[model samples]
Target: MSTVFLALQTNEDTRPIIEAILQDNPGAVVDEQPAMVKINADGRLVVRRETIEELIGRDYDLQELQVNMITMSGNLDQTDDEITLFWKS
Candidate 1:
């Protein structure tokens, strides 16, 4: 059990995409913040810098997964999992 703080733009479709990702990886919990989504999961925690880029890779335009910022903070260990996210809506 590890905690991963994900900061990304929000949209109606984004939720489903995130859900699918979480589903793929069990033991992952998704929490919604003001304008961010917190994902606490197990296994190797990967901080993909180009998450949004790869998410909407070569689609209509580079605007679908327009992630203004992506950062991970707080403890990221299997033993203790906790994350805090800050964003504006």
Candidate 2:
């Protein structure tokens, strides 16, 4: 399976976002760097707005993720409710 990854700046704002990603994506591996956190999963990864909202106890806009996002891999599909990354094959 192809691996998909999402890297984001490490900060208070992203702490809940990272938690949401882990809750939504099972088997995802997290790698922490100096100022960044990278999560890798085989084949696919997903980020959900509802999950983030639940974690942070407030509404969340999926676009807000762009603020802390550093980079990512895989084909991207985004919607008002969620963002998904996956390999075509």
Candidate 3:
């Protein structure tokens, strides 16, 4: 399986996003930089709105992530509940 990744700017707002990603993707590896956080997973990565909301203790719109996003790699699929990234065979 190939790797997929999501890069988000590091800040208070993104801390919960990163936590949610890690909670959902047990195999994901995180790379922390000075001002950016990148998460890598083999084959697939998923970000769930529900999990993020729980982490942040409030309602969350997936679109809010765009504000802190820098870059990503994979075939993007987004819905009301989740965002999934994967490489197509």
Candidate 4:
């Protein structure tokens, strides 16, 4: 399977967001860099608003992810509830 990745800035706001991604995507691997965190998965990665709200104990908007997003790989599908990345094939 092809790998997919999402990279975000490392900071107080993104910490819970990163945790939510890991909880939602099994087998996802996290790589921590000096100022960023990269998450890699075999074929897909998902970020859910509910999971982020649960982690941080407040409501969250999925679009807020764009603030910390550095880069990503895969076809993207985004909705009010979640953002998903995966290979088309």
**Per-model TM-score on C-alpha atoms:** 0.45, 0.98, 0.98, 0.97
lDDT of 3 by residue, 10-29 (tens): 89999989999999999999
Tens-digit lDDT string for candidate 2 (6-63): 9999999999999999999979999999999999999999999999999999989999
Question: What is the TM-score (0 to 1) of candidate 4?
Answer: 0.97
Per-residue lDDT for 2-53 in model 1, tens only? 3445455456646644654454446557777787776655433333223423
Q: For model 1, give the 10-residue run with minimal summed lDDT.
A: 78-87
| The best candidate in terms of lDDT | 3
Q: RMSD of each candidate? A: 9.5, 0.5, 0.5, 0.6
Better of 1 and 3 by TM-score: 3
What order do candidates take by TM-score, descending?
A: 3, 2, 4, 1
- Model 3, TM vs. native: 0.98
Poorly placed runs, candidate 1 (over 4 Å): 45-69, 73-89
Per candidate, the number of residue pairs that clash is 0, 0, 0, 0
